[model samples]
Structures are given as C-alpha cells and as structure tokens.
Target chain A: MADRRPRKDAARNRAAVLAAADPLFARCAHPDDVTMADIAAAAGVGKGTLFRAFGDRTGLIRALYEARLEPVRARVEEGPPPLGPGSPPRRRVLALLDAVLCFKLDNRHLAVALEQTGDASPYRTDHYERWHALLKELLEQVPGGADADFTAHALLAATRADLVAHLADGAGLSREDMRSRLAEFAARTLGTED
Target chain B: MADRRPRKDAARNRAAVLAAADPLFARCAHPDDVTMADIAAAAGVGKGTLFRAFGDRTGLIRALYEARLEPVRARVEEGPPPLGPGSPPRRRVLALLDAVLCFKLDNRHLAVALEQTGDASPYRTDHYERWHALLKELLEQVPGGADADFTAHALLAATRADLVAHLADGAGLSREDMRSRLAEFAARTLGTED
Candidate 1:
C-alpha cells in the first residue's frame, strides 16, 4: 500500500503539471515558443521531473490535449441535463451549443493553439461525432420523426468556432444573442412549434 | 473608335483569363503549384499577356477571387427575386443562401484555399463584413425583427466549408440533405413559424 501510494502521487503530479501547461500553451502565441523550464516552474515541479513525466515536447503536448478534453468528454457522457441526458433533444442540442460556445470563448487561446498545431486530436473528431449522434437520436424523438443525420449536420455546422468567431468578432454579436438565436433555430429544426 | 475596339478586346480577354483560372486554381491541390505559364496556357493566351494583365502571382489570385465574387455582388446589387430586388426579405434571404451554397459547393477548392491561407488577403475582411451587412439587412427585414447580427453569425457558421466537409466526409451526410436541413434551420432562426 505504501509503494502504491508513491505511484499514485506521481500520477497526480503528472496530471497537475499537464493541466497547468495545457492552458499556458493554448494561450501562447506559439506553442513552440514555450519552454519546458517555464512549464516546470509553473507546475511547481523540477525540470527533470517534467521531462521524466512526459519524455519530450511532443509527448507533453499530446498529454496536454488529452487532459484538456477529459472534462469535456465526461460532461458529454454524464454531466447533467441539457449537456447530459434527461432533457428533451431540442434542449439538449441547445445546451450542447451553450457549453461549446462558453468553452470556446473561455479557452479561445488554447483552442487556437490546438487548431494551429494541426494535430489530429481525437477529441475534436470524437466529440463532433458524438454530438451528431446525440442530435440525431434526439431528432428521432421529435413528434414528426425528422431526419436525424441531416438535422445533426446542420446543428453542428451552425456552432462551429470559425463561424462563432466571425459572429462574435467580425459581426459584433453578443454571446447571449448568439445563444438565443441558435436555440430558436434548433427548436424549429427539431419540429418543436414552441 | 478603332483604337477603342482594341482596348475592349483586351478587357474581354482579361475577363476570360480570370474566369478560367479562378475555378481551376480553386480545384487545384496548391495555388502556388499552378504558375502564370499554366494559367496562360489554360486561358489560351501568351504568358507575357497574362503577366501584363495581372502584375504577379498575388495579383492573379486577387483577380480570381474578385471574379468569383462578382456574380454574387451583382445579384445583391441588381438581381431579382429572392436574392435580389422585388421580393420579401424572407425569400431574398433564402435565395442568398441558395446562391452562396451553390457557389461554395461548386468552388469548394477555392473556399478551402482561402480559409487555409489565414487572413493575409485583404479581400477576406472585406467580404466578411459585406456578408455580415447583407445578413443583417435581411434579418432586420424579418416581420417581427430579430437580432440580425446574431442570426448572421449563426447562419455564416452554418455555411463554412469546414463544417460542410465534416458533414460530408465524417458524418456521411449527403449534400442535398445538408442543404435542406440548413434551409430549415435558417428559416426558423429568421422567425418564420413554418
């Protein structure tokens, strides 16, 4: 048990280091500009420990991406109503958009960084597919039995980051306004008169 | 008058060169890979004439973009029906979307190239602002008057090539299906109950 405790502590430290580094990298103008020493200092771990934990810069970046997406994955899997299960499909779709919008706005830096790196992060593809599937399932539950796959694609396209950024930054639309409009759109597409 | 006819011929040839190269470059794997020589060959003009018409590679690219957008601009300015004058705002909005979708789907390569090139081109900013304005104007014309800017952002986001690619490639949604759902979503966001 004592030996197991040390291994667990090491794992916790590794996670903490990655978590701290993830946002920093995301917010940086260029991820390559960040140094391992800076990350170690921020994580409160020795530089040697940082290298030992992740092996190299590429490894660290991969770990950071995974750490960033874990909560997002869990939220979609089992968080609560709107984002989770139990809510109507229309509401769930709206909630998903809300969550995604908030996440993108709050973590714009990291999102931009991840996008710039061009790594095939599974989170993006997996989350998108999951959202589409969920939307499709919900659409099927509608009174008129709408086309789930088509509806899902439309909903997903309307919530993309580039489109959102164009709206928020380019068109000067407020976050609340965007959210409301999206919700209304979702409701209509799902065949809910209300 | 005879000299003026020569000038008119030059203008016609220039227009032809732009039209032919724009679609070809858009579909090509890399814009840089296609040279002035290639464009001239494709346009059935001498390389020297092509160079004289557009100063350099950058100039040629700009011309291509301008040529592609000209029809859209003309429609917005002087066309008729849903995308032009003498129609309800609701119908015009749908028409504008139909035009854009068709253009995008047909020139997907150009769309992808523009997006991948980032914000280096001055045309990007200008077009973005113009599209936003157009969307806002259409939205304001809605019977009850909704948030035009927000609706614009959501609608623009729904039409991005990345999202279209994702739906077509990742989710296997057909083009027809995506278009219908998007139209339905757009109608709802515009506040038409039907």
Candidate 2:
C-alpha cells in the first residue's frame, strides 16, 4: 500500500495538469500564449512535475487533446446509434464526420494548437490512423462505387481542424451552418444523399 | 543602356536562382536540407542576392511555388477547354482538380515545405483563394444542387499538398493512381459520374 502512494500521486498530478491546461488552452488568444509555467501554476504542481509528466508543450497538448477527446472516442467505441457499432455504415459515416466536426468546433483552440505544433503531421498521428481506418472500413461497406480508400481520406479531409477553423472563425459559420454544410457535402461524396 | 543592364542582371539572377532552387527542392530528402546558402551556391549568385530577391526562405519558397504554378495557371486562365474557359463545368472541374493533383505530385518537396511553414494557413493564401473561387464557380454551374461553397472547399481539400504527400510518399500511391482516384472522387461529389 505504501509503495502505491507515489503511483496514485502521479496519476492525480497528471489529471490535475490536464484539467488545468484544458481551460487555459481553450481560453487563450493563441495556443502559444499558454505555457508550461502557466499550466504548472494553474494545476498547483511544480513546473518540473508538468514537464516530467508530459515531456514538453507538444506532448502536454497532445495528452490534453486526447483527454478531451475521450468522451467522443468512448461513444464511438461502445455507445449507441449513429456513432457506435451496429448502425448502417452510411449513417455511421455521416455521424462520425458530424461528430468530428462538432468536436473541432467545440475545441477550436485546442485543435488549432495541436495542429500548429509544426512537427506533427495530422496524417501521422495514431488518432488520425484510427479514425481513417474506421472511416475507410465503413466507406468500403457503402453501396456506392466510390473508391473507399481515397474517398475516406477525402471525406476526413473535409473536417480537418484547420479547415474547420477557417470556416468557423475566419468565415463566421455558425455551428449549425457548418454541420449542415458538412453533412450535405459528405452525403454527396458518399452517394447516400436523399 | 547602363540602367537597363542592372534590371536585366536582376532578372537573370532571379531566373537562375529559381532554376537552381527548383531541382534542389525536388531532389532534397527534406526541404530544410536545401538552404539559401545552398541555393546561392548552386545558382552561382551571392547569398545577399538570394535574400534581396526573395526576402527570406518563406518568401523564396512562395516565389518558387508561384513560378512553378505559372504554366498551370496560364493553361487554366486561357489555354483551352477541359481546364480553361469553354468546357462543360463538370468536365472542367474534373480537369482542374486533376491538374492541381498533378502539380502537387510533381512538386512534392516544395509543396510540403510551403505547407510546413507553420504560420501560413493554406486557406489564407491567395493561391488557395483563386483555386477555391474557380472551383466554387464551376460547382455552381454544375447541375447538382450541391452547396457550391462548401463543396468547392471539400473538393480542394482532397488535393491539399500534405494530403498528396501522404498518398504519394507515405502511402506509396503512384501519380496515376492518385489522379484517377481524385478524378473519381470529384466526379462522385459533383454527381457527374455515369
């Protein structure tokens, strides 16, 4: 029991740092404005703890992004209709994209921060591969003669964080507007439009 | 005659620098590996001339990209049907995307470097706006009731430089395969497929 104390503390500290970092990233005018020191100060942990936990700013941002993405990931993994297993592939594809768009809309700052990390290719991430693989699998099951592999990439590209930011922030598209536009676009691409 | 000589020399130097830089960017394992010094040495010009002509690395890259894109731009602007002004909007759209895809495929390293510049949003570039606007205009002319604005963006997103690099370099797709797949994807999105 005594030996487990440090492990428990480490977990708590990580959660605390993530919790503290989330709102800081969300509220910042720019992602670069929120630094390690800010996160450590906000989390009530030492800067050493913050760096030790995440290695660097990019690492911290990645973890925070994943943490924030947990709910959506869980819903897709096991929750009910439109997102989880058992739904029609066509409907699931639309749902998945809509969910992704909404998630980006909701986490605009974080998404931009993660993408702006310079060294990370959005295409190279584990998160991207998981989404791409699932979307590609579903696309292959659709009845249309669309090339599933390329179509999957094209469809996912429509919801890229940078594109979403351009539409939402730069173009002033409301959430509902962006959602409907993406749905229509995806449906057309999928040949599933009614 | 003396005044004109300096202008001619500057023009010659600029052309030489672009000629030298083009092959270097295309051949380098990474864009960062091909620096201004290397370009100047290859062009047989002073590094000062390189900076004076293009400002810095990003400026130089932008100029080189524009210079390379010039022939493509000319073809679309006035050359002939399919990519130019008189073809059916549907066919023209397909041709336009194919041209963009091929250009990215040919200029993979340059495209990647330009995209990886970190601060420049691809969406914000004049080059992107021109392509998007032309694409949007063509989509509006197509028979489908698709949202021209969003559909144009979605279509263009498919041919983004990084996405192209991922397909060509990372995914090991050949140029022919990518072009056909993109053409098919665009056709499906436009509802112009047979």
Candidate 3:
C-alpha cells in the first residue's frame, strides 16, 4: 500500500476517511465532539494524511455534508420536471424547498455540524448561495414576486438545521409529519392565498 | 460608591455591567470574542460581581438583549394599534414581524452575541416560545390560516439573528429597505395574494 501510485493511494485514502467519518458523525450527540484524531484513527491513516486531505475539521464536515447532499443537488439542478427548470415557477419553488428540507432531514447531524462551525456562516457557504439564488430566480417568476429575494431567504430559513432539529427532536414531530407540514406551509407561501 | 447600601450598590453594579458590556459587544467582530473578564474590567466591577449579577455570559447577553428589547415588547403586549392584541389578526401578525425585525436591526450586536451561546437552542428561549405562541394564536385568527403553528415559526425564522446580521452587514442593505422588504413579504404571506 505504501508503494502504490500517488494518485491511486490518495484517492483510496480520501475514500477511507469519508467512509470512517460518516458513521461517527451520525452517531455523535454533538458533531464537534467528533475530532480529527477520531477520523484519522477510524480511517487507519496518519494524522498528516487527514490534514493534507481536508484542511481542518470544518473542511471535513463540509466535504461530508456536500457529498451527502450531492444526489439531491443533482436532482434539483438537472433531474426533471418539478425540481428542474422545466416546471412552472410555483411548482419549482415548492420542489426546491422540499428538496432542501428533505436533505436537512436526511442529514440532520451533518447539517447541524456544518451550521455550528465556529466561524462559518451557512449563508457564506457555496451551496447556500446556490440554493438561495436558484430559489430567488424561481420566486421572481411567480405572480406577486416583488420581494422574491427576501421570500427566498425566508423560505430557506424554515429548513435551517437547528429549526429542523428542534422540530424533529424537541417537538417530537414525525419525519413525514414535518415534511407534510413544510410542504403545506410552502404551498401557501408560494400560491395565491386561497 | 463602595460604602453605599447593599441593595443600592448591587443595583448600580448591575447597571454598570450591562452598560459596559453593550459597547464591547457592538465593537467586536464576533460576540463570543468579548470575554466576561473584558466586560468586568470595562464595567469597573469584580469578575465575581459580573457573574453574580448575570449567572454567566449567556445570561448577561440575554439580560442585556431583554433590556434593550423591553420597549418593543411593551408596545406589543400593551400598546395600541397593529402591534397590540386589539388589532385585526392579519395586521397584528405583520406588525409583530416588523417589530421583531426592527429590534434586530436596532440591536444587531446584542442579538448576535445572545444567539452565539452554546447548548442554547434559540427555540428553547422563553422569549421565542412567547413570541411563537402569540404569533400562532394570532395566525389562527387570520382567515385562510391552516397551519398557523408552523407558519408562525417560519415567519419568525426569517428574522433569526444571524440572517439579519448577514443581510445587514454582508448584503449592505439599509434599515428602511430591510423593514419594507420584510413588511411587503409578510403582507403577501398574511394577505390574500398581493
């Protein structure tokens, strides 16, 4: 293993770190409690390798979160009708929000970890801007869309990690119930009031 | 000053601590960066006194924030018109969101400091529950209100401290612009299509 090609060994090391880190994050009560040493030990790689591969704990969490979210992002960006640009603005907005909610729901621990990073604001993240911009653009196409920017932000705020965590754990709402409630709320928000 | 009555001196020290802490929080780039030691020195009080008065850093931030927000709370709880309970539900909801947003704008530093505390979920705060319950009740009174509970949370989420700080500082939006945008968005939300 030590004598393997550089590219091949690095790729193997990267995969090993992610594989080891995912379950630790999932099982931890607090994400920050999972540390560099833990990931390095679990991955069976040197601490130096961990540092070289991911800049820091935050970087590793971000990578893990992004990796977990990739499938959903792919679907939203290009998969089809509702999430893709093909659907009507109203439907697309709902799809986008639901996708975001489901992503947070599915990755609660990762989301919480990413959100709780010391100096990182979720708003400053590349994906947050992408999601917000996509939603804002869709919102502009809706009939009464003057405040698309703020509305886009407000809708996304509903799916924020801590809020989702609170509703899921503190409020004890079932996952399905939370999803349906969010969908209903978004529909009302995006639709002409009934 | 040292020889004053215990009750009077305690009151003076408490007031001094809050007064000193306020500017330090406002001037610092990050809220948590301002230490209790820093505040104690600024207030000319012993570290013991600062802790005794507020319990902890989180306690101090909460007290200062509550103190700053008292006027707005008073208007909502007792004063007349849109913010008061006497107003129509639809109008009251808009007023409440506006008032919350304005308060965040007016006290950005304090809000950020209060929010960055550890082990404290913003959802668990007394003020948050009070505001949520009030908004939920008012929302139920508004026509076309189906999911009033979730709707209330969603609306309030729009005014989260970090988001406000980001928009104010990162987005560089003026206070009036933010208020109007929020008002317009909430009106659309509470109204039967703008």
- Give the per-residue lDDT of model 1 (tens digit) for B67-97: 6878888987798777887788888887787
lDDT of 3 by residue, A1-194 (tens): 47755688898999999999999989987776788899999999999999898988888889999999889889988899898769988888888888898889889999988887767567899999999999999988988676788888888999999899889989998888888888887776666643
Q: By DockQ thresholds, what CAPRI class is model 3?
A: medium
- Number of the top candidate by DockQ? 2
Q: Residue-wise lDDT of candidate 2 within A1-194, one digit each (tens)?
A: 45544587899999999989999988876677887899999999999999998998889999988888989999998999889999999999999999999999888888888876766567888888899999999998988557888988998889878889889889998999989999988888777456
For every model shown, the clashing-pair count is 1, 0, 0
- Judge candidate 3 at residue B47 and give its lDDT: 98
Rank ordering of all candidates by TM-score, starting from the highest: 3, 2, 1
lDDT of 1: 0.67
Displacement of residue A11 (Cα, Å) in model 2 is 3.9
**What are the chain A TM-scores of the candidates, in order?**
0.67, 0.92, 0.93
Residue B164 error, candidate 3, Å? 1.3
lDDT measured at residue B148 in model 3 versus the true structure, 0 to 100:
82
Give candidate 1 regions above 4 Å deviation. A1-66, A115-124, A166-178, B1-63, B120-124, B168-177, B192-194
Q: Which ten residues in a row have the lowest lDDT in candidate 1 chain A?
A: A115-124
* Quality of model 2 by C-alpha lDDT: 0.87
Q: How displaced is residue A78 in candidate 3, in Å?
A: 1.7
